[model samples]
Target: MKKIKCLGLVWLLASGLTGFAKDYPVSSAKELSALSLKPGDRVLMKAGEWKDQQLKFKGNGVKGRPIVLMAANAGKTVLNGNSTLDIDGSWLVVDGLSFANGRLDSGEVVNFSEKSFSCRLTNTSVIDYNSSDDKVDYTWVSLRGTHNRVDHCLLKGKNHQGVTMVVWLSEKPNYHQIDHNYFGPRPELGRNGGETIRIGTSTWSFHDSFTLVEENIFEHCDGEIEAVSVKSGRNIVRNNLFYECKATLTLRHGNHSEVIGNYFIGNGKPGTGGVRIIGEDHNVRDNYFQDLTGTGNSAAISVMAGLPNPILVSHWQVKNARITDNLILNCKEPFAIAAGYRKDRYLPALNTYFAKNIILSNVSPLKVYDEKVVVNFEDNLIFSTAFSGEKGRGFELRNEQLKKGSSGLFLRPGQADFKPFWESEQIGPGWFLDINKKFTIN
Candidate 1:
């Protein structure tokens, strides 16, 4: 009877029928790599500063029973100085780890390998991780494969030449969700490759990413004019906040994408851009832009002219663009139509619709660089004290009174329950709430 009972317990463990999974406490990367974790198991790293640890956590876990690797203490376990992580399996979670004071000359700081799927990286912080040589390119986080999530983390102060985070694409669409993270200040890199987040690339621009980038806060991210560069088709960017970030959320090489319900607060800063539109079948709607001071390609909305017979990496012509229902206030040159209309690049936006937009600015609202573009403008209202004589084809000058709402944002009549953006306490790791007090509105 005793032998039979022991064999039954072994069978239950082997078959994963038991709810009790083992939790191993590891002190080093060597111990972590040696352990074979099963579904529902956990490997907790001991609390302290771990230096130069290259941790490769690979395992397979089933649905509803993901293998977890986390810090023993949420914010106390720090990985510094040349540390990196690679997650290379399905249904794995990496949580509550901090990477600080690290410099990787090349290679990513955290990589979800090509085989990884249904994995999550949450409540983590990568702070000031840079390469000593600013020209050396390396991504901070690289997400490969499908069905991955990166949420509630802080990616701050990436001053290198490469992107801060990237979503790699393949033949099939990668359905990744990137939400609720705090992307802190990144200074200007002066050249290309300073984007905070890039989804796909020019080589993979024709593929569908199907990625969702929502509810993130981008504060002071002045990295080469693109805060988030969307380079694939069929993606959505919604409800995010861009605060004083001398950059635009550019749809650089995508088609059929949507940018909706976002806030761009420029605070009258220099080189503060809003959105640059390209490609076909795109929608830009329901966004609020305030106090922006950029013009031309950095206007609140720039419908760019593309190159004649454009290549894969060149700017494509904007076609079938729907720009509607946006609130533009106190921005300089709010609409830049036919932007970048050079001699060689004169392919104008075709069959575009601009409607139902409310603009209240003291400056001139429209700057149509090209006269041959076919854009239908209707149901748009404009009220500018400096441009009361400004008359255009598609908009009427109406005196609409604006009032401050409960969220400290000025709004028009019949518009209620609107928020300016997320508070700093609402994003990032749970332990890093004090960052809210560090920022001041200009």
Candidate 2:
């Protein structure tokens, strides 16, 4: 076994870095963490391999200048947490490091406290080794902080899920941003793998809000994105790319959020689709779905009322939501939007808009499972489904046989603008889609 070396303090002090009160160079993660860190102190890990250790920080930093913890050189340093990194501080930054292959008895590798704010982890790579059972063996990064950003990183693993970033606002933590990352190719088999980014309301708090997930690449994971039971005021997920995954995105039991400007490709397995919506009001617009080919089952987009009866169907319901300005290409079945609460429960669709989208080269353009549900539809383009069983390019619901409403499947001129409806009011085009086509409203 190669022994790791601890660089001297003189080397770190002479490293010529400013904006800090003092600097500390650490050889081992345990030795580095044992020191008492203050508000303006900086800790630099020298170039070496660290193994089977947990690096923890329990310090405080002020608002203006944060305590900096980073690798000395870009690719020269490695933090091989054969265990994990538990962070319990505010305004700390970790950059330019590598986190690889660790055992997870607790199901988590990196855990953050709610009080940690404005922290950032960037330019890092997290790779996991294949286990005997072919699982990733741990959850990559577990979050519970506000205004924290994780960007420009590569996270790849097997068996367990990828990054499970959660917010516990009751503990005074909110506003997490996860952007510009790559996630894929878990070591495990079967579809038991979870999502790349799983955003859910923490059990500690009901006030989770203001989470932004964008510009990430998700490929070959069982489920790409899963947002479950988040009771927040504003959540934004946009401008992402999904390829060769089981499911693209699923939003369940959430209120007042926007899912737009995303690209979904090659998904559909049994109970999955490109985008699935259940619960409250949300804006699903300006997205692109293409080549969703698989054996199990898939749709471009599926919106259904939550489970009913004793389950207490989401009180707000799927109301005041807009689904427009999207393009669905080469799908097995394009749209599956249905109403009527699950299992004999009836729910009405109020102020819901499904308009100005383009569906091309699909077996059936639109498949409305239920008819009693009232949906406002207008100005959509459905190309070349005139000869198969339906006539005259219009919306087809409930297995291409039943048609409902006046604004059925038909080709229209341009897309609809859904920016005004978003909570954050910050809208942009998808990852690689044409921006000129996005701003032009029909």
Candidate 3:
């Protein structure tokens, strides 16, 4: 092992030139700790397994010249940190590594505590295979820092929860991005098993804001993808795939967030809904819901603004939200929304926009409560039928008046010509069945 103090500065300059790449091979974890890395310095970890070691780097890098710690080869390299990676520095990049078997009595495997600026962890795999206990080992990756990015990582474990990525306003870790990660298959026999990704403000009165989760895949999570309760705002979730999750996504109490371009499949367990929006000024659009079958209770989407019973007057105002351009198929029940104010306190009305969607194989397509709740619906296609002696139609809206027209019904191409029997409905597009395309959605 070669020890080089402040060698990061030299490597920083050499990183701009091709000659410096050969000299900066970080062969051991011990040498990685000794170097005072700066911006543009690239530390390459050789291909081998290094177990039960704690590697720490306490240095800062510039914006354009981030200090990078990546794999020397595209081969298998493991870091079995029996503790955690406490990232306390800024502007660092850790890429292309596999971290496993992190044994912490408590806390997260990767702890980003009280750091600022930005860090990127890409193309990494974190696996926890501890089957000895039935307790959740806190979070796999805890984000208490600002503007960090975790991308293209596979996080699998037998813990209570998968990821607790959060931000607090006072110690506010704002502008964080968690994208293209896979969170799934929590330990089957664990207690207190809950959300895959839990988002909330810090305990010390911190406000979280500007978080983005996109293009991720989540499966077999016992709880929802998100649990937000604080005054965080501007959170965006788009283009992700959810399967076998209890609740795909939920917004307890937040404002100005958006969920768009997502695929939700097989959510809602025995008695629940799929996507629950319980906040203010939220937007849900361009989503696809399919095959949500459980114990006789399922809704493609549910929105509830206010609190129920003992009713705090201001709790239920899920106001000024929009739901549009969605496709709901094979759902056990229709979609629903609820809004009301408490009698004790005076609250304002709730308004919504539901438009341009295709709903198939359900008893009802739209359902709402309270006459004062204004919901606008247009350009939606509804397909309903009764095979078991039940009266089913193309449209059903409960407790609310819906405006329907010819533009509202957008039948599929084959549906316009061929009416199949009740048992022969097509589940997906015809292009998926074509073998010559060389690609499929399955």
Strongest candidate by TM-score: 1
> Per-residue lDDT tens digits of candidate 1, residues 290-333?
88988989999999999988888999999999999999988997
lDDT of each: 0.89, 0.60, 0.58
Q: Which candidate wins on lDDT?
A: 1
**Lowest lDDT block of 10, candidate 3:** 431-440
* Tens-digit lDDT track of model 2 for 1-442: 1232234444444443334477888877677778887667878878878787678866777666677777777645665546567777888877667766655554566667667778877776666733434345456677677788787667665465444444445444368888777665542344434556666642322344678888776666654334223445467888876655665476555567788888776634333347766556688898877666531124677666533442422433456778998877667667765633455544545676778776776375656665666667677666645325433334432223222113222222333333221222222212212211222111
| Residue 243 of model 3, lDDT score | 61
TM-score of 3: 0.73
Candidate 3: residue pairs that collide: 136-160, 168-172, 168-202, 169-206, 169-207, 170-206, 305-316, 306-315, 306-316
- Rank order by lDDT, top first? 1, 2, 3
**TM-score, per-candidate, Cα-based:** 0.94, 0.75, 0.73
Candidate 3 yields a Cα-based lDDT of 0.58
Superposition error at 432 for model 1 (Å): 1.0
Ranked candidates, highest TM-score first: 1, 2, 3
Count of backbone clashes, every candidate in sequence:
0, 14, 9
Q: For candidate 3, give the lDDT of residue 297.
A: 16
